[model samples]
Each structure stands twice: as C-alpha cells, then as structure tokens.
Target: MDRTELFLAIIAYTLIVQTFGGKAEGAMLPLFVLLFALPIYVVVHLYRNPSLE
Candidate 1:
C-alpha cells in the first residue's frame, strides 16, 4: 500500500484496538512501535523493489 493507505490502516487499527482491547492494552509500546514502523517498511520495500514505478 501507499503511505496514505498505510496511514489509514493504522488509524483503523488503532480504533479497533482501542474498541476491543480498551485503553490500557492499546498503549503497549510494542504495538505502537509496529504501527509507526509500518509506513517505514512500506517505503523501504518500494525503494528496494527495482520493478516498481
């Protein structure tokens, strides 16, 4: 996905996490880190893919 799509995914995931897991579980550092890093990984993956436009 592109950055905008990834960002929206993160937002939706946050909402889902908060709705189901509630406040305390939603603040877990690991989850937050993964959420933030997702876009970085996407960018890196695109850069590394020689075939992509």
Candidate 2:
C-alpha cells in the first residue's frame, strides 16, 4: 500500500460512490476534475521539487 496505490484506491472509491450514490446530474463533475487534476498536480509538484521523499 504505497502512496500511488492509496491514491488510486481513493479515486476508485470516489468514482464508485459517485456513480452509485444517485446524486444530481452534474454533481460529480467537479469531483471527477479534482480526482484527475490531483495526480497531475502531485506529479508536477514532485517533478519540480524532488526532495520530498
């Protein structure tokens, strides 16, 4: 259970809940954006600052 695995698990759970929870029409869109953007942001940030780990 590394950081990537945990991040993916969280994204999977969020997508499952959003798909099955029966919310409004466009409610999950922001969550979808966040889920997609977050990894990219993390990757870019890590690339710029490689001293994190």
Which candidate should be chosen as best, given TM-score against the real structure? Answer: 2
Cα RMSD to the true fold for all candidates: 4.8, 4.4
The digit string of per-residue lDDT tens for model 2 on 1-53 reads 98678767766767787778887446556567767988899999999999987
Off by over 4 Å in 2: 1-23
**Candidate 1 lDDT for residue 3:** 65
- Cα miss at 20, model 1 (Å)? 0.7
Per-prediction TM-score to the true structure, in the order listed? 0.43, 0.54
What TM-score does candidate 2 reach? 0.54
